[model samples]
Target: MEGLVKKLNRRNFIRVSAIAGGGFVLGFNFLSSCSPEQRPGQLIDLNAFVKIDTNGEITIMNPNPEVGQGVKTALPILVAEELDVDWKDIRVEQAGLDTNKYTRQVAGGSGSVRESWESFRKVGATARQMLINAAAMGWAVSADTCHTENGMVVHKKSGKKAKYGELVERAATLDVPQEVNLKSNAAFKLIGKRIANVDNQAIVTGQFKYGIDTKREGMLYATIIRPPAFGQLLESLDDTAARKSPGVKQVLKFENKIAVLGQSTWEVLQGAKMVKAEWKDDGILESTTDYSKNLKSVLLNEPKEESRRKDGNVLEAFSSAAKVVELDFEAPFLAHNTMEPMNFFAHVKKDSAELYGPIQTPERTRTRIAELLGIPEEKIAIMMTRMGGGFGRRLMSDFVEEAATVSKLAGNIPVNVIWSRESDMSGGFYRPMYSYKYKAAVDNDNKLIAWHHHSVGVGSSAASGDSFPAGAVANFQVDTEEYKSPVSTAPWRAPTHNFIGFSEQSFIDEIAHKIGKDPVAFRLEMLEQAKNNPIGKVNYNPDRFATVIKKAAEVAEWGKKKAGNVFQGFAAHFSFETYVAEVAELEKQADGKLKLKKIYCVADCGTVVNLSGAETQLEGGIIDGIGHAMYAELTLTKGKPDQTNFNTYRMIRMREVPEVEVHFIQNNEKPTGLGEPGLPPAGPALANAVFAASGVRLKTQPFIKSGLFA
Candidate 1:
């Protein structure tokens, strides 16, 4: 059995024995120095992420959630490379939620690599230094003469070598180094290599456990029957038939919804369907309808939050311009459509509770659970599982809260709340629908003069107002109009940039067309302005953005002809601290339809870690962007979503996937975000390509509805 074997108060260090396979656990709590403030019996410290056992096997704890973004594999690679351990000899374990120990345990904004890169490398370097010190002491040689390679310390003068396992006992006695040396990029062995995911075998063999697969002893299944439309209040409920259903355990009513519990998921689903309920409309339908029309009206008349960005005389620029281009773009709300739906398992007692699920922000989940159950924050334990897909969907913990509430009401019998496919799809909290009106002025020489834009949406939480061209253009102004809706919304994928990139890039392409300039060359000129001329404050690196744009164009043969009737569209954007450019190739089919033939993408996120993982993320992001831009749409009718499941809500099919080529700029700069940067350029590039082929510019998303794809 494992135990808390050691507690060294000198440095606030603690150890647990026999982890994974009889290895010692080490952790440091800097807060331990401030007593009285630091709670008793609780050691809130950054725990040791690397462990070594007697057999020379190692375990690396991954502190962030793995929502198919490949952080599960990429972060651990940093640890193994710095520790000088062979990739084959190490295993990765998903760390339990402990915000104090793993300070930035949450995963969002594509920051997993950027945030953990240095600290995790330091963790490995520190452990490696301790092992080398122990080996040098054992060999009676100078520590400087001892070098580490492949998890072993070698003494050059005496030709003595010791495995890390042999030095673990001695290493634990050494003081933690204040600063340890980290290897240069050239010395990395595992970081940049093409390494398979540590859990690939388990995944392929169907042994991987996701949040939906979480189970416990005496666990009950639950299904929530919520209102069909937003702002609807439950008027009455009839759970008599549900309670008599087969395998039905209990039916409970909440303030806004009803929950049906059973011994199995199928029974819970059946029971939920049987419990009839009526809801009163809370004026949601009267306030919102015909999303596009309402948004346009709001943009014209509603009071707006105007962004503070003025560089030149915008009124004079537009009045004296040789030409002006105006376009309006709209996109509908989008659902995440996570394959594993929303689910969580909660077992709450009087003073403590344990929640296990796939949560992107476990800290938020813990806090919400505590507030809902009236338990202390420390009493809640959150265990994260492998997620099927997050795409910014799991960032919110509403499902976890429901499970905790149901568990409390069910006498703390371990309850697992599962959202049905319909409920998951129809439920609110989606990517906010948005509309944009852009007006641009250009001189006779085809140089851009001024830019004005107004955006209307339900909320401006994520990426709504921060358009990229703000600093790139000399005179730019932005305004946003908001429409209050009971339908909840949150960030989806790249947040506001996802849709803004499509609209903004597409509009820029249109301006280029009106001026009889190549789209790629026009964008290049803009980047050069941000690079050389004086802009207010360019948030993106002009050199990096231009590099990716040039690289993507070079790779895709920007203006060159292909074998068939193919045309190319190019777009570039910076988001999440990373720069990416993409080009989509469209072929005119014989049936008057545009076939996506191929795509080329180039990214510069700095210091590549796990080349294979980064490429996978880029490919996934590009495809996701293409799917949402081409076919995905969620419309509201009478305050109710029109689509529920995949049948009504479409997605990009495998048959529609084009040949994708991904490239990354090589550099030693700190790695930035990868999971989201590739996505922002995909939609605009695709739409631009379609226009080049058909001369029909798409001013709205979901080309299917816009009649461009059709």
Candidate 2:
């Protein structure tokens, strides 16, 4: 029984947990599609979908959404492990926009595998159990005596065996295992090993489809024209020219917006540009520089709400401080810049509404659409497609609403509302621009004393003005002076952490340099302080924090350096229960530009499920941080984003790609997040290096320093 239980849990295979005499089973499809009718487009033909046919070919319905994050490969590897099938014999198919079998789509937050880890295993394990039980009942043997291996249950005592494929029909009728035993880390044959992305073949072959590649029969493509400035309404419009344009279906004008509904994407693009509409500028709105300057002014005068740490008298500590280092930092707004942009396909009829697009939170989006359309949530079907890149972009349902509204406008015809690169840029859900004022001090013996950091920034887009100030920082005292824009805001990967990464860590770097201590050593000292004696009441895990920092130092040769122009700075951060530490090496090029030669990041994110996928995230996240550190900035000159696309809104390119080395700390603990933790450390490490290289205390962000730009 123990052997079978261990086996059952190890692969998320079938269980006799709730079954009587003869047991039951379920596979990947069974779990992902517990109730087939509920899933939007469940597979009717089980042959091509996941099934154990006569020959025991373990077929799997490859969950849609080819997220570059490696879920397409990592998720199936989880299922294949649980199913106990020869991985070489597994068959995969793109689960069509089917909500029944593939609900809760739009993969982000590094959740595809971890969130569905046990559940997907249950699906595969249950199916295998059912197969084994059926074979046992047929052979008149006790199910306990028969154990499954490589898709066959062998009656070890009698040396009798039967293939799982020979009992598919009977297996499908068995009940699912409610309670499943998961495999120990030691028994894992596939997980934690390097598994290549499953969709690489389809993507390389041009067979993989993103939302931009989505095409439907008789589906009209459309483009929208929103007010250029928030609080600005279109006073007038001219549609005559657009109506005459080739393949243009209709020109739509509603309140402050316009849409060029057309037959193809090109026609919509051309028509929308031709159908010119003028808008009076809403001068009352705030521009980038205006907001920055005003926010800085307001934060100094205004007192903020408090919900975080505060212990021994900060005022008294500051008053008696022998030395104090105080500085302010600012960061511009950021665009998600997802290559596919925000687009959705919606077909709403009287009976039901069917939708397909790229979304990170399909469950949440479905509920939002149901409320807006006044349709029952059950009747609203959602399908997810491969995201070009989310970066926390698709979490917004505004695009989904836009599609539904357009579909209703097109006389309930299936409408695919697509936003161009400019639309994506101007549509305006941005990484909120922020400012930080920090003051840190040290006493006579160079012992760190009081540290005070005041944070200011735009609120969460998902929560709007309703969020951010509530619990954005620890010891967080945030003063939110609402800079309301018609331009919406939403979650950009790591939320306020992006700005805090710049503000807190960079300020810490300044403090590190003043105290004449290694930046890594300084943060570790804080972690030590935070652990041995915390300042106030906050939910911070200092042990993990110290572990990551110490581990990072070990891997990066944090203290030892032979000597070269390459100046190294190290930083570590803990967020979302994951710990990451980064060491960056930088030197001045002959051209006066900074050259990032290498970055070594050691992460303790608990158990690493897929080595290749986690490493990719580490690499991508590091580069993402580098891009924001070195070049990426969203400046506002005239109440509109200045850097609209990649041309001005530059991302780190291949040549600028730093040599990144990632090492994961192995442990028996369950996995935590690997997505956003590494991001917080890059800016501080790089900034510290800049100081070491130039002998200039680089205190403020837009790290190049305005004088350098000038």
Candidate 3:
């Protein structure tokens, strides 16, 4: 029976619990599409996601990692609103990975809010309906006469009211409500309202605990010495000196690296520095400082290429064009540099294991640790901690694997692995460096007729032309050439959009300048064409895209002069089912350096769950984008990362961040991604603004800050 319960399809998974004193606890499988029989404590399952205690307090579980994206607060607001419960009456709790009960717990690609919207609403509404039914049963009245408000059920004419705590017992007896009514958009109170983050007070007071703060009784700290470069392995290690270091407990050598365990983190750090290891190159990759040259070589002579998208006749359109604009753009690899670095705690035993850490993909973490420790997935328990930052870095469980391996090798005692700042930065899994070639054709009348884009990288897609300006042009072609590398890479923030948005929008701005039109007007013209006579199946809504573009321009007062030598640049993009437009304002200093003055962002993500949180995400993304464009890059030599710490890898200083204003389009469209959509356009807008202020066409990334205004 337990095995069957664990194997039940997502839809068939349901859990119910009775409170000690009075109320009922219900765990709604938001991902479940089918209804199953309600089982209360007969089979094993996870604790409930939604619980009503005997005191009428509501506890809602947020399945996704907070990762500083505010899903912790935003998702619970979603449930509380639909449940018709007062927001203040609900306490949000972080849920651990439980594949049998909670699927889709991973947080990446700005999908946490977008994916959980419908199901969480259902979870809340279903619980509310159950409470209403329970009240209706207890009052001996038709359920139709009962409605829920402020955590209580009211009988309209009978003048009888019952708290949720008093009605839970009856609710438990009733069958689970298969269908429940959802609140109308106009009725949403807690969702759209600006509510403070649940952890804001804790965060401000330095009482909030992150993965770095995790500790256990008798836990040993382990520090690893990995290869300085990729394609290298440890040939020999002399850890005898390390074991003799102060507070050093043990020194273990592995196939690829060495680990030093000590009584304290300080001891582990000192002991790790004392260990000596020699690495032998595998000869898989050679040392190189020029990524741009390598990327261009791949694009020029790649034997195989894929045309991601093609429409009309690109060659013929270019041949008949009165003018052609062509350019090349490249962006370097980027490190995640999460605030807390990568750390995890594990206690692996022969039959079972316990793990805790800050990770975005928790279920995958459990599965991978199980495979590594040779334990049943069910026997391995994973506890999630607050992450200082994710930005897609925590999506990988390599840190967890290291901790589990250390624990297993050390007699299955609890081990906490902590990566130093240098180690975390040098560790691979960076944002892949990418390069692109863009060609645009315009007639004598300045009407765009053709577009061609070729991108080269390990993760580059040939179909980038399919993003924006796809259906807007009659002739569009995108070709992709891939280059394999020994270095590891993964999605960073908006992934491809992070670089694609800058290249595409910057080229569009160049075309608009040559055609003697305002940048904003040029995009609006293309959006108009896409709306009226699109060349192909346009995946985006033309109206929404155009709306945000126009709104951003209006708010920024495009073409209007501000105080001092300020210039404005405009760009817009659509990604993750959301539309965003940004206008960046720049001021030139007396010394010919550029200073960001302000940024205006307008978004159409559809029915924002938390307005304040949404705005903060946009603001953060804009600054992050600016920081990367101005000073962030990861170079490689011999398949190894060059940047090792914040000293070398630049971050946006507090003073460097500019004032930002955010506005959202109001509609009932389902909420889309907020984390990434705002990021893609920021780079282009800032680049365009740099051109406006400095009269330099910045084609490369990290913008060569010193030469920008030379």
Candidate 4:
């Protein structure tokens, strides 16, 4: 961490770039240190990080990624409230993922909103004060009498005002202001308003371009074919017939794979079909399920260590308990079926390279591609676009590396490598299949006295990057073993929140049933202990947690019974300092299956920014989470993924989507994460509702396939 400012504000304003021929046209930047030439009575482009364009437009840039959670809308609302800008004119853009701009670019762990509140407001206030200073200088009057409104400078005595647009170039010349006053939440206008997403217009229309849409001229499209089984290598490839395919240009054979490069996407596919290729697994191909079995034994019996916390003794309490309850939960691997498949377009011309695509981690992708290509990081230019849907799939850099390799093989020409829908599904970068084993014991009054929870899976950081180690419970232990897989894994929505919601919440339910206590009351009791009890350094805001639970219960009418087929199941979880509670309604249909009716979601993820965006995330999360619960799994046969595409891998569809109603508590606090916080609770909530209706406790995932309904 350097004390000194690295450089003056530069107008290298990052914005959406329309692909031009084979490369993007670079722009001129503005970075000046002189007093701005701003009009005497206009909004100032203060030395602060936030700035307003003269056209009454507002732009706020910071470190957070907008992976469909509406960071662009939520974050700017925090600054626009203080900067005195019209909501219509505000334009939120991605800040350079620089340490100078944002301390942490890693978009997981739910730290987005909690980490940036003070820093973002400072940026806005600094700009506002500069406008005031510039106004007083022009009016030859004391700055105290001047007031700012709608990006204009107002002088009461003289009845004089100036538009901010008139101050653009002048504000660009001013020194960065050192001090500025920020508005309190009491004076805010947009903080609690139900604004829609700022980027929605570009998204809904066909004009919204994703990384997969990035195009380059004189560029080739490529597709790679690898060994069908995991740990297999390319024995050999004969491309004699492939080179003759229409539009086919070249066929390349890497160590273990073959790539077909051509002038069009169609040509690449055509050539790939003619290439003769087979894999030699080197004798490492084994059943993915078999490896998972080995991993389970490793976690359960392999000398587990206590990586987290313990507030009380468990051995004595469990021994004396009048009752004990136990259950094991299992979840299979999940795929992030983003609408637009993974795609990246890269062009390397001798020394410098250009890349355009949908990138969640632009800086990381740049570094990785540069390293692989033996180029300086600065020599690479990266541009990003709105995603069809990311769900943590775009966080990895391998797709970018593949594009770079294809571009190099195709010579200096820019190449766009678009992964076909089949390619995206078959190529393995997925949410790891997971499982959890739990044990709990209760005292004479049915109060929970002792508990032990252990989770087993691949690539799950039950306690990796976050401040809270998995051991957040008393007399508790968590063990995770990364089950070996040929497929790589990245963070899926809510990450371990998926498994935690199941194991922790379900155990709570089982305990309630064993003790003859109401589920909600039982949860409240546990939360009372959770409030006073410390669970390591990781944050768990007790008050907010209670708020969502109470709010959800009140709205869902927990005590009321909807007779007939509809049954209600309630669940609540806290992650990323945000709390979400959901009540799922289920109906046992004539076909002997669970049918979802309606889901009520109440969330307190701190403050709400984009009402539509927040609700959309809630609605989408429930559907996706429920989809996994009802019908989605990746079964393995001899170390190979058996499910190939959407035909076999079903998702919750139009008929399956339940009527969803989401209510956000109006709070003055700054925003927390909205994207993933809503996903974890949906699963347990849905499962709970199903149990209420069927009298069956479904512990295994893809519950339908587990024979609960069958």
Candidate 5:
């Protein structure tokens, strides 16, 4: 029997069809816009699906990328919750990227669950209503009297019950409901509960396939030799030895790189090593010292551009202040260092291309490939794999484009390009190096009256002018300068907030100590002023920000006296529309060394979809942030990255990770972002804790460089 389909609006549609062996297949188009005239079979834009078998088996398709952020499990739970099905009865599958069907399919910005919360719920609730309506017709009762519970439709008065699978044919014949009532927060059975990640079993068993594991029939492995330095161009190439290498099939040159294709990864790498290439410096060869000096020069002597934000006169306030504090902070570039590295498989045919990989932005990648290959966008198919790690590296499609380019250039054959650890490290696109110069003024009463912030960075500005302490102070000004470097930079995790949070919060902590007030209390006071009486526009919600700060302080015993060796530090930040506060507990060892004891984190990301996933995100973000802030730094030596691999690139060791306790403010407020908000506060909290313990302040990232943490 053919299924019934209905158009809910210009952007959404629902269709129900009968499965071959007596079941129901429900498909929902939640993103793409289509006309009513589009037939159900003709509309291939359905992004989400729910299927039921005669045995009452259930299946759900998750449409977002899974980058260890738990959206793979959390999004499907939204559908399962409203479907009123047993969690064990449902099977989840990852959906490939379909540009015509899904919007916002990329996994960056921590927006998967937050953006799809309401629509995913409607998908399941609408399907449940259809099933209830089908059962009601069979029982000769009103649809309103039929209720669903645990995948069963029941008639309350008549006491007739039918499994959803049994009513598939009837449900398939009914019109799709325009709207369905969603379960209230208290009625949610699976959302807030702690459920294991859907891929846990696969991962633990080593059955999960990452992008690097992709293999296709007769596909050749490729390794590309790229420029050695940031401002270098390929000058010469000799590929005779590379082409004659064992298992090598082809050696091709594209732009400034040489591609070596072979039967295996090892063979391709060997072939690439045999190729002789010469590079010439095309621009200035800059070093880390150059970046620092240039930025400091701009911060000290350059004329400032129009202020990003300004309230009262900052100069006047500073001139009349009883005391003023000035401090300089610096952070170096950082690599994404994803576990899987960069790899993509592409089969570029005459009219179409098939691509498979773990790319964060599939639509954008497809568009770029289409433009490069001179093919229609629809001819390109991208299947996103479960990424071992993305952070923000996969957001760039350079690797995917390389695969497509190699495949097309090598006689239109299938090719899988994989980057070695060194290649991945030196391939550029790192987090920009940043420097902040802050000046604060206080009156005789120790009341902070003015705030002036000047920041300089490579590529882009890392300043959020309207963030916290903006409207709290009477006189505030923020301006930034960008240094045009020959290095590439992209968003890394929380982007600007990652380092800015540390600089701003550490400065706030310093100011609090200078004024003889508790760090937490001082932050709360500023938040109170921003909430009640503000100096300018306040971008963040002061109340929510204050709540997380108070919670973290209370949970960590912020101001409570500790052992003679233990010290605590507090920091709070607002980013990605979520508020987070963290307290770092440190122990001063007998040898004058310090060790991180534990971290207490409190967040207000609104409703938690999956308790386990939410907690895991918070923990992961904290660990990642702490690791980067404490040890990770990517520097340049004559336009070449000084650290190319794990040996040179210092990473926080496992033993160095401290215990983390995560708490969430449970509310029905719309979910914001959880993946990144937890990160921005961790670094500053740890820095503050170090200062409290040693009475020595850290003004630079990779605190080990100070020879204190070492």
Candidate 6:
């Protein structure tokens, strides 16, 4: 049946397509845990696609969009390692969106490398084997007697060597090996090495083309005027002045928005400023004070929905506990604030549409555009551009949709929609504000017996029942409630783990201090219990989690008394299938001000690909985590953001950044996620260190508001 074939094809499949220039093209599916069955008319998955040309040039297509996460460099190294090709001879290219040719092409979730690790290795190994077979046949020798090194196949006994280019013609004719041998861990030459990012030179040289840099022939620049507040809807629009502005071509109104099209970005922006628009409140004009009060009330009351996770009787354990430690934490909504403002280029014709932009979800955006234009899905094409910064902002395609709508409404001419800094800031889809109430029950012996968590947020809950402290406690329960709001919300960085890690780990530290136990030892004891006698389903590897915690503590010299008002704080978390632990060291100045001196991070994301890239990711995540936790906050006043630009919105300065040292646990396991795991623990560690130094328990986010640093 067609359904059966589709289900089986989702597991794994490989296809070799003909090359236009008479060479080889190998496409390997990402999910290879099971054997792939041949199915008619079914397009299977391919995450790693490679091409070998006649001139000995090898090209690897990076399926995932590059949003400065270093997949542009780290992913190709996976293929190059197993393909046995010289790194200098390989070319890396950004792949276009093609559902048939690639799967999981979108960039989000920190899953690009994690999903492609095994399949990409198989891709390179399969191609290498095909070339070996061709060489062995040409030499009249057994395939087992041939080996590949540096893009050449050699007949071991005869010492006959042939470059990959020389054998590509014959290799293309050979049947693909059903099972290919992957190189051992020791065989890797390019994976673990420190390799610079593929686009580093281009970025530093100002040659990189981001989405905002997109330009096309005869393309008109446009700016849109949207409602100033969340609950407001456009009631009236007067664009007569905008139409008469210099270089202004047309001013069109579509769906509560006024678009001013002109020859230049400046002209369009100036024209947009001339447009008059009136808005009316469509619903409740929610403010930060209202959100905070409502969320806190939800946390205090019983959730309307069923409990997310319930284990042994938490009520009974709490009733019989010797002491109950309870704490409530609050976090404000956060904007993505990508360096480059939102921009997209679109041209919708009668039957086809062309889109180019920095989008994390390209295929989804393309499909949406097709539906919006009433065109067939096959007629829409999208080209993904390197983003200045995504941080989960590009996952939404509002800007892309606006571009297509503007183009279609403007005589189907090419149009590029650009948003100013204020427009980008006011545009919704921010990280939802969250409030968490954590309770831990301890017995007379100071043993943690029960854990209960209640979370309330604007849109959805950011708590994972399977994360740490779940299986560690004998009785555990998690309850969550979502509050309806007019403001849009989307994932920011680690998403659920960002706030959960901070609140949960900080509570754990509080409990440890209450029981008079060292933080690191207390966590180790909990992990040991989870490993040996877990209460329920343990989704994380307890040993791996404990390893990073211990490593971080050791590296930071945890619990050792430091001279001159210095204190260290430790926190560990498991997120995105990666284990990360961070230690923050803070010192109090003579003036009684706290200074973040340094941060030590230990991560176990399995085999490191591109050591330089991994370190950069870890360090960047740490800095971002510390910066947001310390100074970033977004508030709403009458449903409009109080801070529209950097002038009012605060960010951590470079001078305030502490020295960060990253230590990666070396191992041979399959690589996991690295982009987000390093972030979750950074905030909690720094907050705990601040508490240790100032003897003040800060429960809210944007630590600057606490005035501890001052």
In TM-score terms, which candidate is top? 6
The TM-scores, one per candidate, come to 0.94, 0.87, 0.94, 0.88, 0.95, 0.96
Error of 6 at 161 (Å): 1.1
> How many clashing pairs does model 3 include?
1
Better of 1 and 4 by lDDT: 1
Candidate 5, residues 275-370, lDDT tens digits: the string is 999999997899999999998999987446778898999999999999898889998999999988899999999999999989888888899999
Estimate, for each residue in 1-710, the C-alpha lDDT of model 3 and write its tens digit.
01011122335436566667666666655334432222331111122367887678889987777899998898888778877888888898888877766765777877777766666776677788888998887778998888888989999898898888887777877887655677878877798889999999999999988877778898999988989997788888888888899999989876587889988889999999988888888876544445577778866753366577889998999999999999888888889988898999999988999989899888878888877777899999888888898888898988899999999998889999999999999974888888888899999999999998888875445235459999999999888776676677887898788889999999999999888988999999999999999987698999999999989988988987787888988889998889999999888888888778889999999988988899999999998888898889888777777789998898888988889999999998878888878888988998999888877778877875557532
Query: Cα lDDT of all candidates, in order?
Result: 0.82, 0.68, 0.82, 0.68, 0.86, 0.87
The alpha-carbon lDDT assigned to residue 706 of candidate 6 equals: 83
The window of 10 residues in a row where model 6 has the poorest summed lDDT is 1-10
Task: Give the top-scoring candidate (lDDT).
Answer: 6
lDDT for predicted candidate 2 compared with the true structure: 0.68
Count clashing residue pairs per candidate.
Answer: 0, 22, 1, 10, 0, 0
lDDT of model 4 at position 155: 92
lDDT of 1 by residue, 140-246 (tens): 88788989989899998888888888888778777766556788887788888899988899999999888898889899999999989887889999889999999
Cα RMSD, each candidate: 5.2, 6.0, 5.3, 6.9, 4.6, 4.2
C-alpha lDDT (0 to 100) for residue 492 of candidate 5? 94
Kindly indicate the candidate among 3 and 5 with the higher lDDT: 5
lDDT by residue (370-392, candidate 4, tens digit) is 78889998788776666667888
Q: After superposition, how far is residue 124 of candidate 4 from its true place, in Å?
A: 2.4
Pairs with steric clashes in candidate 6: none
Model 1 C-alpha RMSD vs. true structure (Å) is 5.2
